[model samples]
Target: MGIYGALSTAVTGLRAQSFALENVSGNIANSQTIGFKRIDTDFVDLIPDAAPKRQTSGSVLAQAHSTNNVQGDVKGAATETYMAINGNGFFVVEPRAGQADGSATFSGANFYTRRGDFELDKSGYLVNGAGYYLKGLPIDAATQNISGSVPQVLQVSNAFLPAQQTTRVNYELNLPQLPKTPKYQASQSSGSELLSATDFMTLTPDQAATTTGAATTAGAATSSLASAGETLTIQIGATSRTYTFNSGGSTTMPAIDISDTSTDTIGEVLAAIQADLVTAGATGATVGLDGTGKIAITAGNATDTITVTDGTSGTSATGFNLANGTTDPTVATSTALAARVATVTADQTDDFLNQSVSGGAITVYSSNGAPAQIQMRWAKVNSTENGGAERWNLFVLTNGNATGSGTAWTRMGGDYTFGADGSPSPAIDHTDLPNLTVNGVLVGDIRLQHGAHGLTQFADPNGTAEVTTIKQNGYPAGEFVSVAVNDSGRVVVSYNNGQQLEVAQVVTANFNAVNQLKRMDGGLFAATSESGEPILDNGGGVIGSSLEASNTDISEEFTKLIVTQQAYAAGTKIVSTADEMLQQALNMLR
Candidate 1:
């Protein structure tokens, strides 16, 4: 029984050494494989019985163990989708069931792999060389955030992106402290110039008789019945009917009557007459008394003009004249916008070369994703004339379909003022450009936002009006340009409109006992009970555009190969010696 047992034990030793040699051979074979983990033979001693000092060594068993925790040398690759694990995680993947319509179909059953030489398939799915599809979390286009917790087979679409309307425009700039082109010399604020309003020339006349005359100063000049015989006439707009008036008589609207008594001040008479003309629709203008006791009428826009005829009699002859208010289309054309604004000095006489003016052009998208170019012109409103304080009036515009002076450049809104430091004081709000309807299309209201005094008034040599940061929350319709996998495991897709969108985030699966994973074909592994359940790892262990080299070293594998060969030879010698001894025993029995 002892002799037979010795022979069986020697046979087991031969088998164990051969198993170790097989492991060494396999390691050397897959030395060039991507993400290949080397296998090592673990020898276990099997003993039959132990009798204190005399124990029989039975045989040896060889078990294949994996060095899954070992890291491999990373190599750069030309493919953008090539990835390598840097830390302790595996790329979550799934095997494809079959190919249909040139697209690789997923099998739903999840698997894991260290191999990441993936490429986009026909259906836009990222598939590895081993036919396993990469799994990742989907990213919402609007939010650009991961949608769900569980990962799914990632696929990208090559569809065109829809046009989006512009809501906000962000601007950050540094303006010079000096005027680029001084447009104002007035001491008052350069308010927005309007089009439909006009303040008639200041009035000057006799005290008693001139009481009927328009005075730029505040005064009480009543109507005089002594000159009630005079007749007054007025008209409005480019083509309006003239209205006649009489003093101390009853009148209904456009044919207004003046007071015969000295009770009515010059302002009261103008107010009454102006009200009657507006009600009659002869002029769509509002009339008011200026501080100089003069009459100021406004129609809110530059489309119309008011024409008045001060009768050469009582109030009409003395206080009122054609200069007070007129329907002459050419009279108030120059001062139309300036007269309405409170402190605007649009009529300043300053040299254009002395002032610094900066201009910038930016493309803003409409609600329908239509492209519209916005021309921003900044002209210095205050210069050395107002001490050293620097101020600017920014004019936003777009080329309109019109060819006339007032209609050529479609002004977006009123002039915006910048502070001495070149920053907006109140900050730009929603500026409506009603006339900016290019050929009838409605471009939405645009507002400028500056973050943390983004606009500065620093002096520069080149007059460089740098748009440090200018961005809009809108884009026109665009076609897919290209796709790339980022280091953060995000799949970024670019569009022809210069916009990039993150479509998906690749997820990784890691195990507590990675060494317990069961090896499979093509550098893949299956989770076992010995290997802990797969956990979601967001540690960003995967690097894109690179590949991981096999952990198996040729020198180490050759060394193991040499030792394994010698061990196998010794095992064979043991078997041969055991056979010889058994033969001797058998001969002795014979």
Candidate 2:
């Protein structure tokens, strides 16, 4: 019996030791396994009693009981709670697709795993080695939450590919004002002179009837006593100016045929001559007859006058008044006309133009006669499909809405494509979308949508997606200022001149049970059932720059190994003692 007991005890001891060894080996082998938990073993004893001890008498013959310490329970291994469970969850894996969808789809397979190694695929999706995609909420192209389901099979469509080459450039300039002056002519006929001519005299009838020629003391000749058909001559003044008349002419002084000759016309001729004299190289005087049968002569100034006398004796002398005196005309001054040519200067203001963005997409505008809005879209090289076909557009609005306002998004330019080989195509012409107006002012607010995750408007509200107003007065060109992210996961932008603004933000998602994620060999985790549903959490509170670490504890595992070893050793001692007693009894029987 002792030998049998010893054999059973030895068997139990062997079983216990083997179980302890197995646990130690497992712990040592999987110490590096992420989320791996070590196991522990417990042992109990078994004893046989022949009868119960009674308290009646001294209980001298109390029945001896067979005692034994043996392995009883071999419980299934329990995992440490601290370790992230590879429980009934699925690993989320992402695949690469083009930007047609702009976002990745999740595979619904519920494969559970504990691995967290991950990396980004060529398409910019976070992926694992097993090719299983990590599941999370579907983020819009702008990085905002679209759906609440945890992304299982990550299906990343291509990123919004950027245009390779610059398709077009915009410009605005203020043109300067022109100057003006008046025209004039230089001539005497321009009504700039006065007239100086007159003709009024008196004569007697007796003087007119005289037939013979008569001589006067004043050097005058008359027709009264001279023989008929005889000629008479008379001289006047110290110069001896003379006149001859025929006798028997029926007039005392032969009608005193005195003729005045001057080009001045007895009026304006003097002023005309004077004006002519003022000019360079004018000489002499000309005598001519006027339309009124008056003889006129032109000389240098008004002081030069002509006089005439009658040759008859009985008639009184008549003087010629040749000054038809009208005032001289005046010429306009030159300084008054010059004042209209003053220069016009403009003040420098905040009219922003030529707005642009980098590392993302943006919209810009121009301020001039009317506000014009320009839409600019940018993307990285690797994400777009058929390359980047859509590039930029220029929008001109008739209504008073600011550039790039609602319903005002008219495409002026064409689509542009960018190549991976660093070549860029020209912008292709596109159809206008629509026209928009607001408060009688033209506003420009360009909308840039992201291709990844189908997210929109992830950039700043006032920064990228809001309407931007450009001034009409003097303004400087807008320069690229900074970058930002929007709620829709789209990239936003700002300008130095405060002209252009838009949204730009990255998208993020959270899983119900992150520990249930599958290991794709890399650092990435795929979604599984063990991992709960994915939640959309803006990078606000929980996940910023942190990473999850493995949950293996070497010291705790070692301590479990020690306890298992002692239990095995004690079971072996029970089997040995039982065998020794059996051997002594066998000797007694022999």
- Backbone collision count in every prediction? 23, 121
- Model 2 reaches what TM-score against the true structure? 0.32
RMSD (Å) per prediction: 11.3, 30.2
| lDDT score of residue 94 within candidate 2 | 48
Best by lDDT: 1
lDDT of 2 by residue, 407-451 (tens): 322223232232333223332222233232323533333223222
Provide the overall lDDT of each model, using Cα atoms, as 2-decimal numbers: 0.64, 0.32
Give one digit per residue, the lDDT tens place, for model 1 in 300-372: 2343544444554453444443343332221222112222122212231122212325457677777787787
TM-score to native of every candidate shown: 0.70, 0.32
Worst 10 residues of 1 by lDDT: 200-209
